[model samples]
Target: MIRASGISLRRGVKVLLDQSEFTIHPGERVGLVGKNGAGKTTLFALLQGELDLDAGHLSMPESWRIASVEQHIADRDRPAREFVIDGDRDLRRLQDQRAATHDDDGQRIAELEAALLEADAWTAPSRAEQLLAGLGFKPEEWLLPVGHFSGGWQMRLALARALMAPSDLLLLDEPTNHLDLDAMLWLERWLVSYPGTVLLISHDTEFLDAVAKAILHIDHHKLVRYKGGYHDFIMQRAERMQQAQIAYQRQTREAARLQSFIDRFKAQATKAKQAQSRVKALSRMQLLAPLKEDSSISIQLPSPTYVPDPLLTLDKADLGYGSTAILKNVQLMVRGGGRIGILGMNGAGKSTLIKTLAGQQAPLSGEKVAAKGLEIGYFAQHQLDMIDPDSSPLQHLARLAPDVREQELRNYLGSFGFSGDMASNPTAPFSGGEKARLALALIVWQKPNLLLLDEPTNHLDVDTREALATALAGYEGSVLLVSHDRHLLRSTVDEFWIVADGQVQEFDGDLEDYRDWLLSRNASARADARKETRALQQDDSNSVDRRTQRRQEAETRQRLAQLRKPLDKQLGKIESQMEKTGERLQELDLLMQDPNFYTDQYKDERPQLLAEHGELSKQHTELEEQWLDLQEQIETLAQSDH
Candidate 1:
């Protein structure tokens, strides 16, 4: 368990936490949430012991291991798989020790080998490859040098490295920021199955709802604990605020009554004692602070002057870079008020199609038709970079509408959360969220009939994201959105377009259906690869002499059997252990389900039972992973035999 008792934390003059206390039990998955700059990251630093609390003590088990993604990765010519494998520090240390030991030292060598096996050192490469694959890296890319990738890909590598580590606690800050829909789904599954305690900071509400079991919110320099996921936290917090408001109103009425009595009778000798007593009573009352809600953004997308059916159309489009096609023979149309979401794996031509439609890139070999009054407001991450840093939000808007008055421009910017100084200040010092809002503001100011948005909610906070979704929901124009944020997608889009296998087509279902489709497709691909491997092996064998082939096959079987014997034994033992652990967990669940088990009658034994349950759960998760790894090894051997 991790506990902070009345802890006080500060960053320079800013007091982020003042005597705040919270406790996180073992194996709990927690989401740490707050507005930007509200000290969510600072709290992570405090937990890692990189920063000290000014007052009170933070305590956790000394033996607990922690893993977190590095903010910066050196651009080195190191194999990506090897870089991720290094995250397993214990495995690397064991390998190093073995290297330093002499072969003649038989006993020492034996001990090292046993230690390595216990640490799963031999399977580290496969594990690293699996992590990389889940994070959107292809098999061929795994052997490439880390420096060969771009910054976003480097961040994905960093995330993979963090996930590769064996730790008792995991801290992920915006882990999904660099991932696409498929990668994000894979990560959600990984985190859900993770046995350790997790502390995550993310603005992606759907992700938090999927992976977080609890929520830790930072508000008014205090850490507030809620009992469930993001949606639960919102409801619970709203109820709490409502209760507080009621209490404050009641107190106010009482105070007014007391003051009325005092004012009415203070001058009379008849009620002097009562007035004095009322004065003390009023003084003794603990006043409740008025509730202050976070300010919300209100976005109004200017209505288009004209709406035309089939705002844009693509015919026999081969979309890609020069001389290379990503999506071929694509035929699609965007009608007025149509809402379509583009879905695909990373580098699967979603962006290519958008770019072609936005006229940022010409179709390699096709024709695009646009309505006479068609206007497009294309917003991409790169557009934020194109904005001049020296200009303010108002200046950016003024450039878009040169003849508009300054007050009108400022008022329009204010609707997008840029008011007064924020509207006029140079955007050089603004945060990513601020820049994204400004970019959207500029797009909205144009009143385009068609909106082509690519990952527009990447840097937005929860409130801002909600605002955008709400605005887009009500906007009277067509929308083509590509986003990993499922909440935004569900709220804003009505249909889906899938880009895969160099073709573009309409998908028949929702996001859940897409996930199932992706999983099934991957499984089929793996099966095909195995079949191809077998076919090639068969051809090679047919070329050899029949007698020689028989002899070689017999020897290979004997060698493979010898190799599989010990692994089979280990696999059985792990399976037995898993069964036992799972039974115990079921028993604990049954006991805890009894309403009386949590009452005072069983209070003395509850902690022990809960602790045992946590330990068993963690053990079961580790055993399951071992079981999978063993299966993979057996499968590899079988493939080699083929």
Candidate 2:
């Protein structure tokens, strides 16, 4: 267990915490949350012994090992797997010592081997591989040098290294920042099953709710611990704030009444003694201070002046870099006021599709048609960095709307959290959240009819994220969001476009459905890979003439089609039934929402409706599972034939 007693922490002259106390038990997963620059990182630094407390005492089990993702990794010419494996320092040390030991040193060699076995060194490589894979690393890239990976991939490697460590405590800071939805899901599951205690700093609400067993929030220079998940914390904290507000209001009224009596009676001879007693009581009274509400920003993007019926259209487009097609045969249409979210694995062409739609990159083939008087506002990671650091937010907005009034621009900037001197100060020293706000302000200032936001919430805090979601929800413009933020996706987008297998198509499901599909796809992929390997090994020496092979392949495909006919027919029937069942269930759900549906008069009918609803739901679940299994089987067989 870890304990902090009367701990005072400070950075420079600013005191973040004054005599704060908290206790963390072993195997507890705690989430540390606060506003950006609220000393969350400082607390982590203090725990890791990189910084000392200004006062008081902090203690934990001295023998426990700690693991955390390194912020920076030097460019090294080492295999990625080897770099991850080295995260287990004790195992590496033993291996290194064993390599240098002489044949005569039998005792030392035996001890080293025993230590290696205890460390589970033999399975280290496979464990490292699994960690890397879960973080979106391909099998072929496992042997590549660490220097070959880009910054985001390097961050993934850093996370994988931390996960590879055998430790008593694990500390993660925004582990899902660079990950795609698939990778995020995998990491969440991995962390949930992690045996060690975890203390994570994340702005992702869903991630915290999924993984954190407890929440430690920093409010007004004090640490407040909550007993449950993030949602529970939010609800409980709100209740606490409400009760505190009542107490504070009551105290203020009592103090005012006491003062009023003292003032009125002080001049009267009969009440002089009472007034003096009241004075003494007033002086001794402990007044409760009103709670300070958190400063939350508000964002409202301006609606476009004119929204064309169809904003843009893509016809048989092949999207990618020169000579490298990432997404092929893409046919998509964007209408006014449409909201679409793009979903895919990392490097599976989600960005490519966004870039192509945004006109940052032209399609290698086919046509991209924009409606008359079309305008676009594109926001990506680069957009944040593209803001002039030497200039202020006012200057940036001024550049976009040179003819607009300065005060009006300031007001607009203020809504995005850049108020007063913040709008005038140079952005060079601004934090990431500030820069992101500026970038968004610039984008919204343009009043474009279409918005393409790629990971817009990356540098945003929870408040800002909610504000962005609200703004996007109310904005009357076409939006295509490429993000891993599930809450944002759910709130903003009405439909989903999945970019996978070198193609783009509308997914007939939500984020949860996409997750299940990813898991099923991954399993099918593994089975296909194994089958391919076996077939290749057996036919290693076989060769056929090109023309003869083409004919045979045609015939084989025809035979496979015939074999798939019954399964395809059964799938059609199942899908038709599912569609009808879904519609009927929705009707029943709506009917149940009526005010009089559960009243005494209709109570008899309610049981029948309830029974039918329950039976339908069970039938739907069984059918859905059956459909999934059959789909997987068909896919596996199709892949085997290919």
Candidate 3:
């Protein structure tokens, strides 16, 4: 357990924590949350002993080992796997000592080997590989140098290195920022099973809720603890705010009443005694200030002037780069007011599809159809970097709408949480979140009928994410979003499309269902790989007599066919059912588009329609999982026969 008693911390002239006291029990996954510049990162530095507290003490077990992700990687030439293995400092030190030992020192070498075994140093490479795979690195990329990857991919390696360490406590700051949906879900599962305590600082509300057992918030120059996840924190905080507001209102009313009485009597000598008593009463009262809510940014996407049906369409689209087709036989339609979320594994052509739809990349051999006056607003991770560092938010807006008044542009920037000097200041020094907001503000300022957003919430805080979701919900334009933020997906998008296996198809389920499907697919793929390895070994052993080999091969083929036949049949049935579910979902979506379906007159019928949609979605998910299981079983049977 970790305990803090009467701690005081300051940075420059600003006080971050004042007499703060808290205790974190062993194995508790605690989330640290605060607004920007509220000193959450400073608190992390203090905990890591990089910064000293001004007063009081912090205590923890002396024997406990701690591990954290390094923000900098200086050795670019090192292999990624080796860099991760080095995270186990003790293991690395033992290896170094063994390397320095003299050849004749048998006794010392034996001792070192025993120590290495005790530390599980022999399995370090395999453990590091697993971490890399879970963080979305391909098998072929494991041996590559750390410098070969982009900045975001390098950050993933840093995260993998932290997870590779053997420690009693783990500190992760925004681990999911560089991860896609599949990798993020994998990390969530890994953290849930991790034996050590976790101290996570992240702005992703859904992730925090999924992994954290408790929440620690910084408010009003004090640290406050809450008993549960992000949603629980919100509920408890809202209640506290309500109570505080009530007390403040009551005190203000009483103070006003006393002042009124004193004001009316202080001028008259006959009521001087009454006035003096009222004055004393007012002076004795302790005034309570109103509770201030957390500040949040509000985004308002400009409405388009014209919204036509069938805003865009892709006919037999083959999407990829150059001659390589990442996705084929794709057919997608975007109608007015449609909201769709794209789901897929990292590098599974999600971005390729989005780029094709946004007209940034042309389809290899198919036609992209757009309405006569269709306008698209595309938002992607690269868009943030495209912002002119020397330009302010106001300047960016002016470039988009040059005829508009300067004051009008400033007012629009203020709605997205940039006002006063911030709107006028150059964006070069802004944090990632600010840059992302500015990029999104530029996109939102354009009144486009179709919006294509890719990972738009990458650097946004919880408040900004909520605001974005709310704006998307209220916008009259159609939107296609690809994001790992499950909360935003669940709240904004009505349906999802999955990109996988060189094909694009409409997914008939929700985010939870997509997670289950990903797990099943991974299991099936692993089983297939094992089966392939066994077959390769069988092929290599041709030294046996030709007659004997031929007979064995024939028997293996017969047995494998028998084992796979039933599984194939089941897979066919599942595929058929999934198709039906997809069609039904599309029908329901059309029904939902009718304005009268949401009116008071048809409220009674709405629940039945929603219930049917829910039933179909559940069935589709179960079928997909079943299909994956059957595929894995067939692969295992084939390996056994070999």
Q: What's the lDDT for all of these models?
A: 0.90, 0.89, 0.88
What's the ranking of the predictions by TM-score, best on top?
A: 1, 2, 3
lDDT of 1 by residue, 1-642 (tens): 999999999999999999999999999999999887779999999889899889999999999999999988875698999999988999999999999987555556545665887798879998998898888898789999999998888999999999999999999999998899889988999999999999999999999999999999998888999998999999999999999899999999999999999999999899999999999999999999977677789888888888799999999989998799999999999989999999998888998999999999998887999998999999999988977899988888888899999999988899999998989899998878889999999887878999999999988889899999999999999999999999999999999999999999999999999999999987887688679879989988788998997999999997666556666778899999999999999999999999999899898999999999999999999999999987887776677688
Q: For candidate 3, what is the lDDT?
A: 0.88
Q: lDDT tens digits, residues 1-642, model 2?
A: 989988989999988998898999999999998888888989999999999999889999999899999998985688999999989998999999989988555445545655776788889998998898888898889999999998899999989989888899999988899999989999999999988899999989999999999999988888899988888989999999999999999888888998999999999999999999989988998887777779889998998999997999999989899899998889989988899999999889888888888888999999999999888999999887698889999898888889999999999999999999989999998888889888988987879999999999997888899899999999998999999999999999999999899999999999999999999987887688679878987686366667887898898887556546656777888999899889999999999899899889787799999999999999899889979965975685488586
Candidate 3 residue 386 C-alpha distance from true site, Å? 2.4
Lowest summed lDDT across 10 adjacent residues in model 2 is found at: 105-114
Question: What's the true lDDT of residue 597 in model 1?
Answer: 95
Candidate 2's TM-score: 0.82
Cα shift from native, residue 609, model 2 (Å): 90
* Top-down lDDT ranking: 1, 2, 3
Better of 2 and 3 by TM-score: 2
Query: What's the count of clashing pairs in each model shown?
Result: 0, 0, 0
Worst 10 residues of 3 by lDDT: 105-114
Q: Give the clashing pairs for model 3.
A: none
